[model samples]
Target: MVTTKRNKEFCQKVRLKSTQVFIVAGTCLITVLVTLLCIGFMTRYEVDNEVANVADVDYWKDKVASSQKIWYDKGIDELNEALRTPRGPIYPKNLRIFLIQGVDGRDLAAYRFSGKDLSNGNTNFVWDKFPHFARLKNTCSQQFPCPISSVAKSLWTGIPLDKIPEAQPDCGNLVNETETPFSVLRQAQLAGLLTGFVTTQRFTGSTGAALGNTNSNYECDERMPLGSLKSGCQDIARQLITGETGKSLNVIIGGGRQMLSSLVPKSISDPVDELLCESNDGRNLLKEWRNQKLKESKVKPIKFELVQRADELESLNASNFDFLFGVMANGDLSGNSNAPSLKLMVEKSLQVLKKKNQGYLLIVEQFIQSGMNKRKELQLLNETLTNLKREEDTLTLVLLTNAIYPKPILDMSEETETINQLSETFNEAEFQIQETLYQMPSESLLFAIGPKSSIFHGVQKETFIAHAVSHVLSKSSPKT
Candidate 1:
């Protein structure tokens, strides 16, 4: 009986020790959690403070203005120098063109990879493919690195967004229609060269619209003010269909079918279609464009094809169609399985444009976001460049916008709201959207290859590109 009692006491002691251990562990866990919470709270506080201090809208605006002034002076000097340079005898009729946008310094730096082979087992860098390509320092707009502004300046010499004082300062509004200068594509069209436009963005997006539009208040009909429409302003899509430069285009391929169509009833096959059919106007711009071509066909032997599917695009015999229009998506291209790839579009465009013996100019605009996808895009671009280089007469120009949004104001707290209100008085919201927290202006790069590529070898203003093209094409002898 005494031994049994001793065993029970020992068991009680063991239970007591286990209870004490549990309590001690619980205390340690609680203490650790509290410490973590404190650290997180402190970090968040520091971040908030940094954001508040750095996101001073007034300071940002002042810095932009000062920097713009410096660029403007430099641009003026470069423009004058280009004007003074001897005009080269470039054969316009023999020259085929590929003007590419959406490359940046990061892309070029990737080429330097310490002479190492890429993970994809490619030993040659993209630049190595075109050893003759000249690397030039390209500048963005003197005022802002807006996509529309940069494009306008690149297409029409000496004209940037800030220079157009008459047009309302907005991304959707390009040059004043009355004051609009002839674009490089327009010049090529007038010179009897077949022209084409290809993009991964909306067909009516800023880059595409700047090619042909003027005094445009919005990209789509739904986005335009009724007053503006009544005042004889047309949306970008309408401009592309009806405008002189736009109509003369031999090839038009990209996305943004929703902007062209009115309430296209979504079918079961396209249940996940992201295109919202946002047009309230009772007109289908695509049909209108087709009808216009059809009417012309009745008068002449004009062959045209309009397609909405990637498969349809693939099946098309580009040589059979004098004009090709393909809207591969409802909105901006998502590079999905069904959408036509950038390289595919370029190949098709090349086929269509090459048919015209008078020569051709193709504007390929791609908007690449930052990160790993950018690398993939660079690879695709290299493939396209290879195809372009196959034509000995083709001159390909790659334009890059580095950090398109420079020093973006990230914080939009109460303090920022107050700054925005103050800035609204000075039209800051016009160029820089009040709600946008990212994107800042930065330097860009220019790469060129083929005949007369020497003209763009040095650091020059963005306008110099158009100036050089104008000089070469206008002064050159026509092909026999």
Candidate 2:
């Protein structure tokens, strides 16, 4: 009787163990099945639907510009209305957005990182490879051939280029700026954020027009040439220096020494007009600005500092100032001697902007020329991205390769060295036009990373950026 009971108990124990083993095996099988299903779904979604080699120029231009032609026929007002209404902001993380633009549109064919070595060199190739580019394999996307004027307007105003006259051919300038994305920053500022504009050239043409009416609290760019202030759309500089705008800039840095009276080199014959065909204004804008800051310092908590070198900028005691304006270059830093690099300008801008305890909007740019300038700007941006500690908190938009530069004579001999050399001189002070009409098909590349940057994924409308930026800029801190 005892042996029979022990055998029966042992059989029960084996059966229970077998049941547990079956359950564990079934669970493992389900987990594997679910994971495979997910992988399949992700693989299908991530499949590159729109990628091809630019082997033929005619086909490529025809395909990309086809949509713009349809838009071009649409009345200018119709385009304006479309741009006025930017797409909804889909990204709302607590973030910062940096708008880095290539003033001239870029060509996609010339920027590929294929053919072994992925490096863009000073020696330009007819098809230069920009290895520094983070191939948009996952999320980064681009739009082609966005014109500079329309691009500038849409970027700041949230209007699309397809919806507006790119620029007035007669005026060679932007149409108007009745509105801007700065409205989006109103909420952000109440929460302690700052806004800034820094570029290598004078805020002239489209740049000046875009910034003309902004009420943001920070702005900077190369000073308008002495001749340009009258018509160069440089009134914003005067307004910042005099605190005449609705919102006073906290920091201003750029180059326009000729306009500063004392900084003009005496050797250049008619120094002002030699730089351009404009300028007779005798106002020392910078001195006037410093004087105003000094007067304001006595009555309020106002603190403002100005410097003219990268080292000086790096050494700034940013904590002491309510505003810091550093004009580190005399004018257009591109190929200029000892000019503060765009990267340094950006670094210092961010450093000072963060002190406001509010988020910031930073617009940085290289002169709209292609080749070495564009390549260097892109390389700097990549470095900046690599070093970012709080990428999640920042939105960086790098716009490259628009077809907006002045057309130059090309060698067209299939010689890499000749093409590269020509590219360096593409933006020569004295340039010749190869084409009568300087219009470009909408075909350059765009890149964005951070909170709302992905809102513009596919072929992004020019105005989409403004809307996305406004969405983040207008974000109030989350309620705890």
Candidate 3:
């Protein structure tokens, strides 16, 4: 009887232990499964956040669907046809082009630099200095009073703002390859000719953007809406680094350094700008530009320089470098002593471009406000023109894109006199301006020299300028 009791107790203990072991194993397995499920949820949440940041396709689809028909110039249809014509294969050697902007006939006459009064029905100003230059007329200003329209009209496409349909806000001033031809700078680049863009305006401004960028509604990346960015519409500054024409440029000198860098930990040498340089997209474009150049250098030896200060620009020996990029300010060049003058920029550009044997196309724009600033720019322009080598193979075009402002009080500060004595005649003279609103259309002028310049005579449509340039460029046989 005692033996039987002991065996039963032992069996009971064994059963109890077996139950505990099964419970522990099941609990452990359940815990492991729950942990794996939690990990999966966390990974899914991270992916969801990323997609949410860019917004869902349905969200963007609604935005695009709601977008109304944007208005543009009526002549765009015809201009598109003209642009669609295939470019010629020929690229002539020793054919150089210089397109200079902001040489207003009215301003020239008002300042008495032309020795003739253009306001007094005197068409003689066109023939006074350079007999070959044509005084082209821009009729788009008669309709749209904005300087923006003037640039849009004279640009590669030569089409003005919307006129046919009711004008809409935030319309016009956009370029697309489907509607317009390649810019002169792009054409020159494709032709294997050196190309440069020098401006006192922001490098991504309408004038500068027109040289290389296409289809961008905004000049900077931050200004673009998420919908626009997602739709593959790149901003102007981004295009400058990635675009075919922009990357191939031999020389680029102007302002807008902040556009190429991040907002935080501002780039070295970036000036404090009135507008914030908010590139919240987490991209450092300046670094990207450098990386691109470095990668290209691996394939072929290329000497390039990226400078920021006036002293750095001045110190550069133009012939030693194949590419030069100088961003002197955050905005349009300020009167900061650290910034190089327009004349200095032009001088350096000419020197660098002239080194190429195939020829070059240099476009220089002086977009400045204030009478004093205009005077200083004009003085520098005059000096540069006077110093030009006047090569027979070079075609120089001075286009007066008049962006009029209210006449300011002509105050002569001692600081102004320090520029040089060459501006003395222009300083003491009384400055006169036609009283008009800021956007009102004013007469524009064009001066030309070199081959085929005689063909441009009398007043012509703004579109005629692009056509004429194309014609001249096409006349040459392909480079051997």
Question: Which predicted model would earn the best TM-score?
Answer: 1
lDDT for each candidate structure? 0.64, 0.50, 0.63
Query: What are the runs in model 2 whose C-alpha is more than 4 Å off?
Result: 1-151, 160-192, 214-236, 239-247, 259-273, 368-374, 401-440, 477-480
Determine the C-alpha RMSD for candidate 2 after optimal superposition of all C-alphas: 14.3
Using lDDT, give the best candidate's number.
1
lDDT for predicted candidate 1 compared with the true structure = 0.64
TM-score on alpha carbons, each prediction:
0.65, 0.55, 0.64
For candidate 1, lDDT tens digit of each residue in 1-480?
999999999999999999999999999999999999998888688667542322221223355677576656555544453333223334434444444455555455665353455443323445443323333332332323334444454445446444643445343454445566777777777777788889887777766766774446466688786667765677777888889888888999987777788765454433324443367788788888999998888999898999888889888888777899988877767633477888889888877877645677788877774443666676677777765544445566776664343322333333344456665534666556534322324345666655666666655656676777776666443455
Q: For residues 1-480, could you state the per-residue lDDT of candidate 3 as single tens digits? A: 999999999999999999999999999999999999998887698677542222221223334433331212223433343333223223233344334455465566555444444433433232245545565544443332334523543555445333212212232334444544477677667666788888877788776666774546466767787766665666778888888878899899998766776553334445556564445576666777778888989999998888878988898898787888888877667534467887789888887887644677788877755555555566667777777776656666777766542222234322233334435534453432112222234446777755566676887766677777766655532366
CA displacement after TM-score superposition, residue 239 of candidate 3 (Å)? 0.9
TM-score of candidate 3 on Cα atoms, chains taken together: 0.64
lDDT head-to-head 1 vs 3, winner: 1
Off by over 4 Å in 1: 1-102, 111-123, 128-157, 165-179, 265-277, 335-337, 407-441, 475-480
* Cα lDDT tens digits for candidate 2, 322-382: 6777665444555346667666776776666765335565566555455655555555655
